[model samples]
Target: MKFPEVVSVEQADQYEQVIDVRSPAEFALDHYPGAINCPVLDNEERIVVGTLYKQVSVFEAKKVGAALVARNIAKHLDEQFSKNPKEWTPLIYCWRGGNRSGAMTHILRQVGWRASQLDGGYKAFRRQVINELEILPGRFQWRVLSGETGSAKSRVLEGLAAAGAQVLDLEALACHKGSVLGILPDQPQPAQKMFETRIWDVLRKLDPARPVFVEAESKKVGQLRVPEHLFEQMTQHSTVFRIQASVAARVDFLIEDYHYFLADTDTLKQQLRHLVTLHGHEVIHHWCQQVDAAQWPELVGDLLVRHYDPAYLKSSNNLFTGFATAHPLPADKLDGPGIARLVDQLLNLQG
Candidate 1:
């Protein structure tokens, strides 16, 4: 049978299955969205082949690698692809679209199923992501939600989305809250490429005619940086929905929302340690003591007044354009009903 032809990653959706033939570690780092990993050579096997290629000879390496590859492929054929219908058309890719994916495609075609390799592999998909991000930001009209930390901007975005508003919750996408202590309890952030892919996926689906409601974020969310074009567009937006809530209300909201911290005091203290340099050792020591003593509301209230609020004021005023004239949306509380009212107010005012 003839070798399968290479297809572009852009045609990914048309295929019945998308197979990633890279090593598990490579796939874990990043892969095309929705591609399933069916590594022909696992991490250790790949290392052995590579070491053999360096120490012995390319011929020797291939001799060893081919057996390992064949065995793994047989296992996959039995376990993963045994039940597939004859008409199954799968798109396969690996790093640089080279030997790994080619082997899988060849084997699958020999099994009488139509299979195609991804042209340029994961590299090509990455390039497409970069190209899309370079232009996608300017395509949407944005309405930035500008507010201090604990003012429930993320919640507001959620409520807006529920109300049929076009919302882009970057913090949620990043699996972070966008602060020194923003790391989620159990959710690890996606790889940077995957993060870009997620942003690209959302941006492509949004209607340019309608405004996309987004939070005003710094250049970085936790460890991931916002795409430059998107961050620039967010800052340039003149239509801002400034959320106003009393510090006491924001404290109450935060206490309820971040109850995870109460369960994991050590992790909470560890996160609080990051603020030590900024707030001084004495202040952080006091904060830790509060956490130990279970002074939840008082601790949150103090952090807002002393640490978060001032930082927010400076950053919001300096970084975001038209902050002085932002449209005010009063939030008496940060509960569901309050957020619903805020969402309604936003839509009514903006509409």
Candidate 2:
């Protein structure tokens, strides 16, 4: 049969195909980057085996499992693996680098291909991801850019990236803006596992000899958790750049970014209600009435001063007191060109 040795995490990067032999449900929850699910046992079959493992003897479980495994493998060879040649090397894994992978590896080998199993299965791979996030910081340099909600931090990162500056756009990788309104217009945010994959892919492409620019963010970005290793690196290797704009200019920037406000009043009302407790009932009531009257500028001004601005100022004052450096953009009469100039200036700064 198809007996194989375990492949380490470092070795995983070199593999062409990463096959996950877990049920589709398990694969949906989270899986190794680049892994495609080709379950040797579907969910119901796995549950049956697991129940047998508890109620019956190991020999009994193996007897039932063997039959299910054989049927599934034949189906896989017929439906999926039939296209690939005998020489294709595939890295296969399951939840614990156990029977599922062993079964698949054996089947693949029977077809004359060189295949391997990931050591420890997906769990071991996850451990490596956690360890990399926790321990691998002393080796690289980082630059962090800090600003309030409408400070154009994402745009600055994009500009820096365009100019060949080493840049890590965490929000872009996570597919969310790291805020309530951070959702993109038409695209859905990626699953957390996919987010990690995107981050890892970008990191692999970077030149460690150059400094990387990233935006400041809490560990959680919308629904995704920032990888611990990368977050740890940001905590220390980071040099911060602060961008400043006046209340009016920031309001304009926010309005431009959130076009949903232009089309739906109900959506705007729901978003506004999320801030009611922070702004207090009476003030929020006034804003609500004003909004219904279509007083956009008045509503924005009050919300900025009474809500978003105060919160941002408090956070900026408390956490970024000793920022690496700060720069001010245009105050009155601000526009895209002025913002672009500010971004250019911030990118010019070296850590």
* Best model per TM-score: 1
Q: Relative to the unseen true structure, what is the C-alpha lDDT of residue 129 in candidate 1, on a scale of 0 to 100?
A: 87
Candidate 1 lDDT over residue span 1-351, tens digit each: 332578777777788889999999999877777789999999999999999999999999999999998999999999999999998888999889998888989999888888999999989988998998999889888899988889889998998898899989999889999998788988999888778888988898899989999998888898999999998889875477799999988998999889898999999999999887798999999999999999998999999999999998899888888687898888898888888888889889877
RMSD of 2: 3.6
Q: Write the per-residue lDDT of candidate 2 for residues 85-192, one digit (tens) a residue.
A: 776778999988888898888778777878888888988877766565454443567777776677677877887788778888989887778775566666687777
- Report how far residue 164 has shifted in candidate 1, in Å: 2.9
- Per-model TM against the reference: 0.95, 0.83
